[model samples]
Target: MSTGLAELHEKARAALDPVHYDYYAGGVGDEVVLAENEAAFRRLALLPRVLRGTPTRDLAVDLPGGRLDLPVLIAPTAFHRLAHPEGEVATARAAAAARTVLVSGMASTVAIADVVTAARSVDRDASVWFQLYLQPDEDVTACLVERAERAGCTALVVTADSPVFGRHRRDAEHGFHDLPSGLAAENMRDLPGGPPGGVRDIVMSPSVSWEHLDRLREATALPLWLKGVLHPRDAELAVGHGVAGIVVSNHGG
Candidate 1:
């Protein structure tokens, strides 16, 4: 097993196909945000409360969906199958074993039900949240939400950024346009406008607005958390809109 992220990344780089590795490693534009995220972590300093006479402390914290043993959560990342055959199923089980949340991506190679099942098999109270980009088509969005709900997801993480797909130079140079044959975004199967077993491509729209979010809020009883809110004004809007939580992210640059 890898001892640290650098070692893990080196192992992954050695094991994965070059094109697939680049697709997973690279980020949008010049990748400034990705560098900054790394820098931020490096700058993190945990100051110990010296001389405190506490015998023990609990790290568990309760969020809208479930209680987490640690504050850290596994954020949504697409196409886990590109890295391993077990894909998100393996990830879900690991997250459950860690006693934290796994925000499963909408673009996961494993279906949401299977992902949740894998997690629950490890820890019965494991929480799996669904992360999605709201489609321009309301029916499609609703259908996706219903799928998450049916799959036993505890929360919905709405990724509000990426009105358009980012320009990943590495992917473009490597010609990584689609998944390898046999692997697909499993949760996208049988969406609104498609035939039986037909998967609808996820569409990003510049026209998506707060009104779309309002409609979504009315549609589901699950806790709704907004991701990709970097601006303070947008964060304020999210709070006013009854969001259970806000994840201020720059999509890892």
Candidate 2:
């Protein structure tokens, strides 16, 4: 039986450690965005339709390259190992079972290849996508994208909003941002750290400009979809750049 999202969330909260639960549920500082998220939903009214008896309910979505079993697709969330032992590998398997898309985050605990392999093992035709956090150096970003292509990622979902990490007070109270020892973002294993003994930053490029997407296009053949776009003007700019698609998001609201 399928549990409601709210129920699942409460169960997860009850199961995890306090610090980890904060990491899972907390958003950026003050959480005004977080509180208002559900508030926006409460204002919406859905009218019930009269019974036009039909058992078949199609939820598929057609796109440029292929079709999704459902319009829903998983977003790129980092560090799945903190919740499950299989990490993104388990997520890929679940996506395969549901015949949909799983956009594995660049900062996932498991290697990108392992996640892809796990999905294909579960279902040979699973469509696995990869998420990218653009690096400071263009060459580095190129290498990462190429590696993802080689790993059999069907598409690339590039994160656009998180040039810098958000400050979450709930996690901060738990010392989640203190830069503890041995806490590495797995995909960033060999990449440059800010300083030898200093805090290990996310290594994303804050100065990544509009033209960078064109350069990214020139780097790989995989379809690119930019995520975390909220502004209308930026959406128009993304269309100009010839993106495959745009995912409207507020990062974590």
Worst lDDT 10-window in candidate 2: 192-201
* Tens digits of per-residue lDDT for model 1, 1-253: 6699899889999999999999988988888887889899889988877877889888899999989999999999999999999999999999999999999999999999999999999999999999989999899999999999999999999999889999998999988899889998999999889989987798889999999999999999999999999899999999999999999888878
Regions of candidate 1 where Cα sits further than 4 Å from its true position = none
Provide the lDDT at 50 for model 1.
80
> In order, how many clashes per candidate?
0, 0
**How far off is residue 150 in model 2, in Å?**
0.8
Native-to-model Cα distance after best TM-score fit, residue 211 in candidate 2, in Å: 1.1
Q: Identify the candidate with maximal TM-score.
A: 1
**lDDT top scorer:** 1
Error of 1 at 124 (Å): 0.9
Query: How high is the CA lDDT of each candidate model?
Result: 0.94, 0.79
Worst 10 residues of 1 by lDDT: 45-54
Once model 2 is optimally superposed onto the true structure by TM-score, how far is the C-alpha of residue 94 displaced, in angstroms? 0.8
Model 2 reaches what TM-score against the true structure?
0.88
